[model samples]
Target: MTTLLQIDSSITGPNSVSRTLTTAIVEKLREANPGLRVIHHDLAAAAPAHVTPANFPSAHPISAAAGDAPEFAAGRAASDAILDEFLGADIVVIGAPMYNFSIPSQLKAWIDRILVPGKTFSYGAEGLKGLAAGKRVIIAVTRGNFYGPGQPTASFEHVETYLRSVFAFVGIPNPEVIIAEGVQLGPDARQTALDKALQQTAGLNAA
Candidate 1:
């Protein structure tokens, strides 16, 4: 059975294009494979605390007596749980919307948790080696305006680029990114972008 971990971080609720597209992607994927199991997480409602120095993990395990506060300990546990979920998933689908040219705070918090040193990546003689390889990542992104190559606001966009770099650092160098751009242009443009994204989702193959 294939397991799909779908994460939605959009705070815009039903009006979020990324969220809708992510659901569509999952449904289309299920069409290709009937036994696909999905684990859905809404980060906006259940986001973990941000990574702070107090809650940071050490290369070696730290005991509770090592000066960690109760809140910090709980935060650490939450981070560990997020990392475990990512490690267990075979496929990851993310609904990421651009907020002020970057990703949402909730998604960033999740990234901080899963990007653990020894689990997701490690430094070796080869410089850097990623442990989480062979997992497929699909990102559904919604941007307010156009930011493709040679566009005026291309330099201002960081959501997709940041995610690509993060996933590549963890061994998924090339992820399938479906984008709905110019969503703030107008109703027609928003619908067009969404339609195009749906087409991409429908064309996805079973992993």
Candidate 2:
């Protein structure tokens, strides 16, 4: 059976369009494949601690963080678990909502945990090598304002760009991105954008 890791990072709870679309996308995937093991991780509800200077020590490099230091060991373990989870998943679905022209700090912290040297990637003599390259990722994005090519806020939209760059660095460069824009405009605009995103979700290549 294929394993899917679904991460929801929206702090808006039930009103979050990204979460709504993400759930639908996972359901669609589940329908396409039988007995798919899905893991749901909510970053908003349980955000991981931010990476700090204390954990930057050579002995506390996440994977080897559990030697003897009790205080730093927990952070190291969390980081290791985060990286391991991503490495083990066949597919990843992320509900990423745009907050203040960027992603949530919680989600960013999660990203820090996974982008470990020699774990998810390595700097070889060839410049850089991506060790974890085969996993498929689907990102569900919700934007309060328009951020497409022609939109005024296009340049300010960091949600997609940051995710794309980060994932590419770790190996998966071309991920399938679905967006729900203009969500906070009004009722009609929100519904229209949401419905459009959901349509895209339904037609997604979950195979």
Candidate 3:
């Protein structure tokens, strides 16, 4: 069976546009692939802690010092589990909403866990190479104001750009993206953007 990882990091619950888009995308994928296994992680409900000196060694096992704190051990275990989920999934769907011109801190924390050096990427004499390459990534992005290409504030757009760069660095270069931007401009713009995003999700290919 194809394993799908569904991640939602919106704090707004039902009012989150990114969450709605991700749900629709997942439903579409399910319709196309039977017996799909889904593993969901709701970052808003159970947010991962930001990386600190205590837990930072989890990614670099050799750098771990002796006599670490109990909390550090627990954080390492949690990060290990998160990395395992990412490695196990054949497809990943993310609901990422823009917060302060970037992705939510909860989502960033989750990212810190998955982007381990030896696990997802590595460096060699040739250059940096990504180990996790085959998995497909689909991102559902929502921003209040317009920040797309050629927009007045496009330079401020970080959600999609950052996600693309991260995923590319980890070996998935061309992630499928569905965006619902300028939702806060007006009711009409919101509906239009939502409808367009839903249509994009409907047109997505199956795993």
- How many clashes in each candidate? 0, 0, 0
Best by lDDT: 3
The better-scoring model by lDDT among 2 and 3 is 3
Model 3: CA > 4 A from native: 57-71
* Model 1 lDDT tens row, 17-129: 99999999899888888999899999999987776765555332442335666656666766677788898999999999999999999999889877777888998988888
- Candidate 3: pairs in clash: none
Between the candidate structures 1 and 3, which one is better when assessed by lDDT? 3
Q: Which ten residues in a row have the lowest lDDT in candidate 3?
A: 57-66
Error of 3 at 95 (Å): 0.7
* TM-score pick, better of 1 and 3: 3
Error of 2 at 195 (Å): 0.7
> Please, what is the whole-model Cα lDDT of each candidate in the order they appear?
0.87, 0.87, 0.90
| Candidate 3: C-alpha RMSD after superposition | 1.6
Q: Could you give candidate 2's per-residue lDDT for residues 3-49 as a string of tens digits?
A: 99999999989988999999999999998897999999999999988
The candidate maximizing TM-score is 3
TM-score of 1: 0.93
